[model samples]
Target: MAPILQVDVDALRQLAIDMAHAADTIHEFDLTQPATGAAESLESSSVAAISQNVSWSLREAYRHLAALVDQMATGTESAARIFEAAERSFTGALRRIH
Candidate 1:
């Protein structure tokens, strides 16, 4: 029996959510005048971090699914089938990343 254990997904989602909230808060601040330097820096960095987190999470999700699919493929199928399934998912994830 092959089992998948994922315990950090919530941490990843919460991190992204927090970054998004920070970005939104900074974005709404009045920009016509000099704003808090720390806030501006936070906004940019937080947005970039959120995007990176999203990209990484999405990639990892696909990789995890591919591995599971590969495991499923091998129950009564050849490695070629598993390879094809993994390739298909990897291709999809690559497309999504782009």
Candidate 2:
């Protein structure tokens, strides 16, 4: 006997939407100005340079994370559409057999 597989495509679609929203929120956040201000307030030039480097690193990391999340949302949305299409096809086949 084969096991039955159930998928909630609507939930997948909603998850994709939520992920896209989260990615947008993360991308929109600005960390550069505050970091630059803090760096400027520092007394030592070397320390300020390090602080700027750290800020740049953090900003890049956030950008990368946002891009990854956006990709995942796109993939999830594609999966939902594929699943829905498959389900519709299966239902149609069953109806034709009856």
Regions of candidate 2 where Cα sits further than 4 Å from its true position: 1-5
Q: Single out the weakest 10-residue window by summed lDDT for candidate 1.
A: 1-10
**Cα RMSD for candidates in order:** 18.5, 3.2
lDDT of 2 by residue, 4-95 (tens): 23788889999999999999998987999988898889947788888889899999999999999999999999999988787777877777
lDDT of 1 at 53: 59
Estimate every model's Cα lDDT from 0 to 1.
Answer: 0.49, 0.88
Model 1, runs deviating above 4 Å: 1-45, 78-98
Q: Please, what are the lDDT tens digits per residue for candidate 1 over residues 1-98?
A: 12123234445445545544554444344432333344356575766455555555655665565555444434324434454566667777777999
Against the true structure, candidate 2 reaches a TM-score of 0.88
Q: Highest TM-score: which candidate? A: 2
Clashes of 1: 0
